[model samples]
Target: MLPELKDISNEEVKLPESSKVRLFIKREDRIHPFVSGNKYRKLKYNLIEAASLGFDTVLTFGGAYSNHIAAIASAGKLHHFKTIGVIRGDELRSKKDYNPTLKFAQAQGMKLHFISREVYKNKTAQTFLEELKRTFGSFYTVPEGGTNALAVKGCEEILKPEDSMFDYICCSVGTGGTLSGIINASKPHQHIFGFPALKGDFLSDIISKFAMKRNWELQTAYHFGGYAKINNELIEFMNRFKAENDIPLDPVYTGKMMFGIIDLIKKGYFPPQSNILAVHTGGLQGIEGMNLKLKKKNLPLII
Candidate 1:
């Protein structure tokens, strides 16, 4: 059985004297060591529904260092369900031992199927799914980022009644599931700010599909290149933030979001005395793999 989730607490972020905004971070990372934050929420009902329908296996898609892939693999092992991970990049198939995320998933008994980038792009296509079913037999399928209706439902619980007091709710956007849930659950007066980990305005459209409210906006400038892409500045900011707050931020999501929030605050974006709560969606498990890439580039690693 999956471990019971604990009540996650929020950590206050001390701001500069020039900015009168009060910032706090909801530490969802503490939910579980492996399947934490949005990963835990997104998979909670998916796993339940999969079992209710008597599915013995769970199949999903992800890249080399996907938190969703790792979370599902861990969850499957704990719940006694077989797991299949259709990983992007065919070259990674032979180098599984080098990729920490894939290695851990495999060690947990998840069967890894590495496919080319082109084929991985069509993962949601009907033909692709049909082919997967023919190859692996029937199984419950979770999307690449684990964002679906059930996932959005699970994320809605991230905010509690006390959180309604905040004027702004901030979070990093991946597939937009977590933000959608937050938008649905947020009070009318609260404005939700989403920092996309990738470039482009397409995320706004994707988020609108699930979000029921119109009180949210996307801050697309802090992506720092694109998904899984990082720089020295971001690395420095992450390390400094951790050193000061004792809260580790993953480069893929939370780190970028927090960085953006601080920059915006410095620029006088928020009115004085505004209360902002940032959602710390956990992706810490992917840090080891990220550090490997940084080492290859001789760049500073996330602390």
Candidate 2:
């Protein structure tokens, strides 16, 4: 809320000589260490609305390593709002110390309520929400991954008039809030592409709920097995990418989206001389926990 607009910069990415299109990545990851990228955009209006409505507390849902949870905790701390994270997998309650994401949230004064995966599936249901209301008592609800009307409104600002020159707008898809915003803000001639981090058909439905344009498509082939699921190939790619680009990518979201975009380019997906702009949605906080898992599996860690 305090003039962070000056920090964002678009860096052109190097491509092979044979490549047909020009590629650039918007360094939204550097916007803020905690509340970075689309998470910051999604929360901007929602937090303001919460304060405007006189809500002192904000509650949201997420997994153990969710970037959304970390951003919310950090945002709450920055804005002086009480935060509650309804974390999935009740088993993680005892393992909180080992999970850096949850630990960071706790350190930021987030009250975490662990729930079973089954119960988390019904998070938006009326009865479950009412039960949570009775428990937490009068808190602003930021839906899982923070996708809501106000959040989408914030996302629409990701693209600007100057960005209209680009032929394509690309970003990682989580709950589809950011993608929907890009789609809504894109120029008529530009196409928006979303690279989903999870495997599912439900995302399109969610994106349609907020998107106001039809110039978008989801590239579904590069999720790397599913949400939070990564292997050696992706780890190696991420490491090599950082070594070359000097830009660190989190394995879950940004890494997969980058991988997909590059792969598509190599496969001759884009038109010749087309300009492509990729949004670097930050999820770097999840890397610590992911590296811990990678250590256990003996997979190469993301650099």
Candidate 3:
């Protein structure tokens, strides 16, 4: 049986009075300890489908500090399925002890297969996937970032009926699955805003394949240089946000989205009295790993 999902709450964000916009965060992070936020949603139906198909093992792809990898490991352990992670960096194999995310995943019983960056680039190619199939035997593949159709189906349930009152629905985009699910389930009048963690126009095209509505726009200005790249300014913002709100945000995703939302509000991107709801797709498990990188670079760490 699947673990019970917790009742998620929308916490109102206290914004500056001059901004003239009201913001709230849907705390999807509170849903589960390990499989939180979009990870939980994305894995929900995929696990069900895997079991129904009689697959005893689940295989997926991720980087050294990927939340998807950690979540899948936890989910597989909880659901009685063997898990395999095709990790992007081959160098990470010897450094597993220093990487909190990978260490945690290993603790959860995931078999880690570290691959070269060049080979990892072809992860989605048919030939490379066939190679993985031959090596790992029969297993249910969850794709990189866990963004399959069944995953999107689970993500669509993130918003509730009361969420329609918000004028803007915002989220951080990775593989575009979570945002696409939100777009498909959103009310017509609500405009969806996506803050991509990666630098690309490619996400717009990718999301289009799964989204039924055209009521969404991608805000590409605040990726903090690219996926998993962080600066002192971002670290300061994350620390201050946690100090004030008591909510910890992961540097890779939620922190970047919140930063963009605040910047947009200050620039009058939203009309006066507009209500905005930002989806907190959790990655807090990655904070420890990110802090290690920050410390190594002599940068201010995310508290």
Model 3 Cα lDDT, one tens digit per residue, 184-217? 9999899999999999799989999999999999
Q: After superposition, how far is residue 240 of candidate 2 from its true place, in Å?
A: 0.9
Give the range of the ten consecutive residues with the poorest summed lDDT in model 1.
Answer: 1-10
lDDT of 2 by residue, 1-303 (tens): 424577477888889988989999999998799999999999999999999999999999999999999999999999899999999999999999989999999999999999999999999998999999999899999999999998899888888778978999999999999999889888899999999999987899999988888999899999988999999888888898888899999999999999999999999999999999999999999899999998998888777
Per-residue C-alpha lDDT of model 1 across residues 54-97, encoded as one tens digit per residue: 99999999999999999999999989999999999999989999
Backbone clashes for every candidate come to 0, 0, 0
CA error at residue 39 for candidate 3, angstroms: 0.3
lDDT of residue 25 for candidate 1: 100
Best by lDDT: 1
Each model's Cα RMSD: 1.0, 1.1, 1.0
Query: What's the TM-score of every candidate structure?
Result: 0.98, 0.98, 0.98
Error of 1 at 260 (Å): 0.1
lDDT score at residue 275, model 2, on the 0-100 scale: 96
